[model samples]
Target: MTDQTAPTDPAEVTAHLDARLDDDARAWFAESRDRIGDDPAAVRVLFPAVSRRVGRGPLAPGGDGDDPFVWHRDDAGRALLLAAVDPGARPGELRDCYTHGDARERRGVLRSLEVVEVDDEVTAELVDDALRTNDVRLVAAALGPAGVAVLDDDGFAQAVLKAVFVDLDLERIAGIPDRVTPELSRMMADFVHERVAAGRAVPASVWTVIDRHPPADRLAAIEAERDHEDPHRAAAAAAALDARP
Candidate 1:
């Protein structure tokens, strides 16, 4: 809502929603484009309460749920807001929208992250906030191209770990394979070891960063798992070993 100077691209929203949603659903997106002016505050004011509790599961558009359908509404609202408040649409406003809005609203803000440009610090803060939550949608949104680019290395590591901790899709995150750091690699190695101890399946994708020159002991542990009964664990172990020299 803060004085928006940047132009919001409705196309950005359409690009994400058009192909995925039905034409009936897509029409509203195009319709919502003109619903706002230079000030996007009015719509946010009437959005679902930040404190409202929406139960789990999918929702119909404008329906009584908090999933994708509800998310669509929130996305449309944000797109409209962005359209009206471009030129200076800051991340602080985004953070505020995500914080003050309900589950779907938070998702919408995260969805809008790519289109709305702000300072790196603000991006880091918003991405951190999203990762801190366990909501799969919000986390997915935070890992978008812009979001990942804005994150500091430490913040990036935390986001990656948090994603794994929640068992979300790493495929949704941008700049993964190329962004790995030794610190992140070490953290992933420890996570792998912990999951093994707990008898939980370490997400196979964790190996993307985990295979980076593990210590001798860790390598030995991975080698030991190669013949374990759990084929997945064994495959993961083998993959880890193969990923290295």
Candidate 2:
């Protein structure tokens, strides 16, 4: 919608989206025809349009309610993010877009990884590269949507740990349940210990990772946190008690 050379076929671009979209999303897209456009295949055009039309507050279908994780939802945003991908674009192009692009562009590429063919080493390296950055937005995008499912065990684990390190809202991360592991709990437990010992405030979301049947010590640590002054931390501790091993 924003670009002149928009894709010639919206049908083709949206063909793979059936499973990814729901009834509400379909209706939204239908009404969004003027913004989404009748012709569309490339992500370059769709991305800007979504940004312009969606206005980045809440996600579509749900309009991003009060949930902090809403950034990863909106079907329009998802479709637009995928538009940056040419499908035929090579790894080199994808790499350039990521390495040279601004934050919005980088996010588009990260979101497109699900549909793009990133079999080559360069593209595959992008995931790790983004994870290593302290840029919280990049980290969030890298771990959003298909990322959690696609990243290797260690990569995904690192992403989660990094989110905590950067003080990112864990809800922004998709597939947190599947990605959680005992080793991650240990890492988080260690982090919580260090932070608490230093008189630094620990994010309550850390308990989200630790709540998944963590070891006894970790469970005890979270349970003790139930008395924390911050309602978020106290709430996390309370919830973890029921879910803990």
Candidate 3:
């Protein structure tokens, strides 16, 4: 049997994290300090979160309370100083610490806050409006794949259809047009078709929109294409078809 030794120094374990800080991260840390005042506990929480994400622990051995590398300070001074010095620290991570942390922490950092709740209907409405304007960025941001999945699962076909229509800029419902719109339509259709071919069901809501908006021939063509190679999509398409009359 081989002899096993316990891990020795924590410092040795994390020796690689001692890199210098870049200019932007340093500037942001200074700004954060000015914004949050000199609260040690607040700084401790904020810095540790950033350090954790950046692969640095909060403390260095034999360091004083003024030690910039110590992760558990209650004031912003050390944290800001450490961040300013450590070039590898990400400004985005620090920003996220201010934004995504608990309410109290965020309030402490930002000083003012507003809470807005956009429900399904409102979100759907916003998505629809965004799509109609061909606002790809807004549409994608508002209804990411996860949001799309949620809308599909919840049977929000009209919403999905509107989103797709707007995103693809489909002017005609049934016939394949001459412009790039048809290509986008075909691509989306093909995507659904593959899903159906794979033995997956399209969300019922998506089916509802397809049924109401598109011409029968176009719909049938899309259905026929469902026999393509994706099993998961195939199943979804079958479910979507079943959801229709």
Best by the TM-score measure: 1
RMSD of each: 7.4, 8.7, 17.9
Tens-digit lDDT string for candidate 1 (49-134): 31222222222333434222133434544544554554454444566776787767777666566565567777677778888888
Global fold similarity of model 1 (TM-score): 0.69
Model 2, runs deviating above 4 Å: 1-86, 115-117, 120-123, 218-245
lDDT-sorted candidate list, best first: 1, 2, 3
Candidate 2 lDDT, tens digit per residue, 1-245? 21111112334345534334567756655555444343333333444454444444433334433432333333324444444344455455567656766665666567556444565465457767878888776776666555666677676778888888888887457767656788877887777755654445666677677766466786567557778887766665555444433
In terms of lDDT, model 2 sits at: 0.57
Using Cα atoms with residue i matched to residue i, what is each candidate's TM-score against the true structure? 0.69, 0.60, 0.27
Give model 2's TM-score versus the native structure.
Answer: 0.60
Model 3: per-residue Cα lDDT over 23-80, one tens digit each:
5545554465554444423444545344323323223333343221122211122223
Worst window of 10 by summed lDDT in candidate 2 = 1-10
Candidate 1 runs further than 4 Å off:
1-12, 15-32, 46-77, 89-92, 212-217, 225-245
For candidate 3, give the lDDT.
0.37
Number of backbone collisions per candidate:
8, 5, 30
- Candidate number with greatest lDDT: 1
Candidate 3: segments with Cα more than 4 A from true spot: 1-95, 98-188, 208-212, 215-217, 223-238
